[model samples]
Target: MFAVWGLIVLAGIFVVIRFTGLIDHMLPAGDPPNFTFAPETPVPQARNFFIACPPGRSPRTDRAMPSPSFDATAATLADVMIETAPAHGMQLMSGVPGGKPGRLYFLARTPVFHFPDWVEVEFILPEQGGDITFCLFAQSVYGLDDIQQNEKRTRAWLADIVGRMGPSG
Candidate 1:
């Protein structure tokens, strides 16, 4: 029993080292993520990063700075809508189907430095595609006291979005 417990502890340590990117240099190029959820959504194929759940607890918004400014600088309008936003962590990047001409709004929580926490994204795409609106509302927190809460929040938020979208490319 003592030997088994020792082995378990060692295995746990190994897993942590692997997770923190320490063992990456020794591994070969990994196969792309075989996503069970969104088989059609195109994931970046050439990266060697592991998938990690977002930290659930809220960020330290009380000390966080304000949102940053985002600009749409693509030649084509569609390019402006989809491609450009996520590059800047614009959560909901999509085209509008009806109503409204063409409008884009970028939003984020305090401390634009730590983006992806909160955002308000929108754009119009004529009469075919529906308007896209991504509104992320999160806070940044630090220390061990809030870790569990933060992680829970992140997972919940991600699950909600994925649940609604079904899957993506």
Candidate 2:
């Protein structure tokens, strides 16, 4: 069973590399402000992504409420996301233009393998003083399937963010 032993060794090596954070260097974080969130044509066909936009902002009309409406301002929501990211194993990525409101990029790694995933969030502030809405797009960097990890992580992060925002939010 040399092949079995060899496989075990390889798996161990990968685990080591992942825990050391060495795999992060090889992953692409993607260009910010370039990713399309929702209501955009030709979304990626990969199954390893999750997109959450407000009710009217997405093409999927079956979803009663795809994303939560925030009572806070975009700036406040951004602040909440920034504060909550690290706790969810995410780090903010650079390259967003300053003075441009409502766009944020983040890099997240899987808990075990450290596979990189890019997350983009766009806050939508209505002109008529309505609740703030947002779109979140999270995609894996090197996989055709992620077993719904992206959706789970996005939902958990959103819940934590809303919890932090309190009753009014």
Candidate 3:
């Protein structure tokens, strides 16, 4: 009976910490599981994990197809991402403005959990001067499922970026 009581108390503390949003600070800095820019990056099977911008687009929500591939140059597209993502509440990580064909990273925070969700973006500029394209990968920082948060976020952010690019874009 005493052990049971102790277990209950521990569980209570865990709930409190999670609810108060205090657990995010104690975690070490790094990308979450299944967070990768490469297709070979393995995703662990679990309930709290989710990944967007996958190969072949099996999960359609994870995919974003912008007409004219965003209608901008490598630098302009990178600027769009840098300028627009934060408006949607994405906190930019390091390595932004990484030259042509920009490589940007960010963390997406949600009220659903205290852990961070990771988003990796790469802008591809044509060597011979063609349409600009980009790839984005987003996934939960923890758990097996993200309730489609990554997908939803990527879609919304893409729309916002396109909008920011304006009439020319």
- Top candidate when judged by TM-score against the true structure: 2
Please give the RMSD of candidate 3 to the true structure.
Answer: 5.9
Off by over 4 Å in 3: 1-21, 32-68, 96-101, 166-169
lDDT of 1 by residue, 1-169 (tens): 9999999999988787666655444432222122221223333232211122112221322312221112222124334334444443444422323212243323222221232222222232224443232212322222223333323443444454444343332
Worst 10 residues of 1 by lDDT: 48-57
Worst 10 residues of 3 by lDDT: 58-67
Candidate 3 C-alpha error for residue 104, in Å: 0.4
Candidate 3's residue-wise lDDT over 133-159, tens digit each? 666667666667777766777778877
Taken over the whole model, the C-alpha lDDT of each candidate is 0.32, 0.75, 0.62
Which of the two, 1 or 2, has more lDDT? 2
Order the candidates by TM-score, highest first. 2, 3, 1
The TM-scores of all predictions, comma-separated, are 0.21, 0.81, 0.64
Give the true-structure RMSD of model 2. Answer: 3.2
Error of 2 at 117 (Å): 0.9
Model 1 lDDT, full chain set = 0.32
For candidate 2, write residues 1-169 as lDDT tens digits. 9999999999998988777767766565555434555564456666787778876566442222377877888888889999999988899874555423557888888887678888888888877878887888787888898888888889899899878886344
Query: Any residue pairs clashing in model 2, and if so which?
Result: none
Candidate 3 residue 67 C-alpha distance from true site, Å: 8.8
RMSD of 1: 16.2
Give candidate 2 misplaced runs (Cα > 4 Å).
1-12, 38-40, 61-65, 96-101, 167-169
How does residue 133 of candidate 1 score in lDDT? 27
